[model samples]
Target: MSEAIRIRVTSQHLAESSNPAQQKYAFAYHISIENCGREAVQLLNRYWLITDADGKKTEVRGAGVVGKQPVIAPDECYEYSSGAILDTPVGTMQGYYEMQSADGNTFQAPIPVFSLVVPNLIN
Candidate 1:
């Protein structure tokens, strides 16, 4: 399938915000969404599937991201930073964005699976 939007993710372990003893692992992720098509699109909603090391899964569905429904023009990019807390030291997240094009067509833009791991957790 042709892609109209591309997503890139970068993750960081937040040591200062994590409590290993309590099984709380905090991670911050920066996401950049680029419109690769010829039309401008507005991100309407998001759906995420997060899985922890123990196979625990959590689903997050929300409207917009960081409180804004960003409209990205063709060849333009939108960036945001978000955080997630996991019970394990490592996990993975993947999802899709619901977008509406300027011409009124709606589509789903897939967000590639990315890892969320604490530094030095694995060799």
Candidate 2:
């Protein structure tokens, strides 16, 4: 079945906030979630699998995003920005959002794997 929600991401490296010497790479990501189904849905939780360049993995689980559980109506969208710190300059993030529809049906809205790379790192 097609997903009722669509997810998109845009990421940017934070140079000033990152300490390369300490292997601390910081990136800010903006996520937009659009509801395409006929029913409205409330985002209940999020689960993320983050992988660093060395193949190290970290799993993050939490309630809501940016401190709010947003309710999105059909054809509407919700957007939020968050940050992640990694030991490598390049990494990937993929995960899913747990959602509850108006009728009390729960489902997973998958967020596609997205890259986080420092500029000029892959020339």
C-alpha TM-score for every candidate:
0.97, 0.97
For candidate 2, the TM-score is 0.97
Off by over 4 Å in 2: none
Q: Residue by residue across 1-123, what tens digits does model 1's lDDT show? A: 129788999999999999999999999999999999898999999999999999999999999999999999999999999999999999999999999999888889999999999998768
Q: Clashing residue pairs in candidate 2, if any?
A: none
Kindly list the per-residue Cα lDDT of model 2 for residues 87-110, writing each as its tens digit: 999999999999999988888899
What local distance difference test score does each model get?
A: 0.94, 0.94
Which residue window of length 10 is worst by lDDT in model 1?
1-10
Q: List the residue pairs that clash in candidate 1.
A: none
Scored by lDDT, model 2 comes in at 0.94
